[model samples]
Target: MIVVVGITVGILDVCELGSHFILMSITIACGMLSEAYARGPPAPNASTHHSERQIPFAACDIAQLLIALCWGITGDIAEIVSRARIAQLWAATGVAVAYMSIARWLGNVIIFDRKKSRFVANAVYGLAFVPYATSWCALIARFALAINGAEASVPDWIIAIVIGMFFGFTGTFPIIHALSINRVIDVDAAEVAYAIAGVANKSLLGWYMWYGVNRMQTA
Candidate 1:
């Protein structure tokens, strides 16, 4: 739950810029380390252990699992942040539903699994920012809320643009695993690109989150 840890750390005194960057670098390093390990020669499958041990990563893999766990924790932290914006939640949900509807139609009408690559599925999953969009979706909802005596904040266009890119890159996370996409990773150095993108997205979201919080507080 590195995410949970990160988010927890974020809430714990708002994380000064330097400390936050340091922790974020650690997070990226975790991803890189995990990638390096996965790229190492694949070990033979051991069937002796129960629980359908397809690939032994239990005790053998410490860093990867720890990172995963920490990320989960960060999600918990984000949820805490989100709970403060119920109006944004509703607004983001609406946005997601509407956006997905149109996306589904487009997917069906065109680009409907032309190649049908598993990697593509994973990449699409990486792009899908279901809840994270709330950071901006809430902003949109705030504007809408003002329509009829509803208290809301001004829609900051700058933050929306920034967060949109962040959310877009956040989606590419899964496919970034160099080990997972061997061919593309080898040819395109996509893993490195993904690593860079991941950090960028996180930083962008961080700014968006902090900006929103700061503005709302002062508003």
Candidate 2:
């Protein structure tokens, strides 16, 4: 299924979509690593506790950083665009880590009571995506522009909000699915939904950034 999705997305445009997928993969990996770390190590019984194997968080984080660097290098090669400096890239990564940490914290606090209607529950979860995506877009755009020596504009914020809402709406799919399956919503469940939705959403966002945003810039 992932391969099929990747092939379809790659067909749209390789460099942009590929870069987006790489970044999303890194984020997802980090999330999973963090979760595993929180869960602790597996028991000595290898057969019974097979699912408990986990990579160290520090190792996963370093690997994710390297992946980002490689993606930047690939983007530069494919697009003939200047890559962000290593320092800038590191800064952006720090921002991302901080953002995810906050989002997770927020998810923990904001409970979606199962007693509420699905519409209400979904709406609550959907609303969270607005700010989450918006801030992410804004930070990335701002940093990219700054690194490229371009002036930031008001439209950047507007564009971020538009894209954020798009992601938010699309992101509701997993949450709705989870709700239907479990008849309730919780932080962990919602986080899983968000992670799942992220794969698809980021793919679409990649295409948008490549075709739509890039075209607008050239025009």
Candidate 3:
């Protein structure tokens, strides 16, 4: 339902940068939900070791990765059709996909491996935010150019970069609660944390972009 509503909102204003970000974010939220459900049915026999029951979880992770790639491509399509090529949008999308794939692999390693390194796991996860931040920065820069013409100056770029970092931090930081794997912490708690981060990254970020665009247009 959230995905449907988000996509609908974007469709209503397909040309808007805010709409594109909103759509991409919402799809990401859905992908997060897919990741949360990676665990499958219990083994039918008690003799079946947990290590042997890897197929279902692996499949679900793949599904989540595919979901991310699809939505990333959707945003790329929007940029290609509706907006100027200010950011080399496809390259950003490709980078995002690549980073996310690596992050997913690291996540699995952290989850299943006995020698999991939390620092490496966290680093990859944090790095995944870069593409989104760059895209947001590009959108803001494009907006400034639209409003200020050739007069869009250094301060404008600085402000956009700052705003992009703010969004990136707010979106990615909370997911650390999930990424920092601990045997003592409840798995459900981690899922809840992830869901919260999804809301911050997707819905709240989208709202801020929409509000900023409206303010800029009116000013």
TM-score of each: 0.29, 0.29, 0.35
The candidate 1 region of ten consecutive residues with least summed lDDT is: 48-57
Misplaced by over 4 Å in model 3 are: 1-39, 44-70, 73-120, 123-125, 128-150, 172-219
lDDT of 3 by residue, 136-176 (tens): 54554454345434354555444434443444446453234
| Ranking of models by lDDT | 3, 2, 1
Give candidate 2's TM-score: 0.29
Pick by TM-score: which candidate is best? 3
Candidate 2 lDDT, tens digit per residue, 1-219? 222332333333223334543554444445444444555544556442222222122434334433433343233222212433543343234323432332222222222111224324433544444455555544444444444454535754454334434444464432343453685543323322332233324433333322322222232
RMSD for each of the candidates: 18.1, 17.0, 16.4
Give the poorly placed runs of model 2, Cα more than 4 Å off: 12-120, 159-200, 203-219
Candidate 3 TM-score over all chains jointly: 0.35
The predicted structure with the larger lDDT, 1 or 2, is 2
- Lowest lDDT 10-mer window, candidate 2? 105-114
lDDT of candidate 1 over 133-158, digit per residue (tens): 44544443333333323332233333
lDDT of 3 at 195: 26
lDDT of 3 at 61: 40
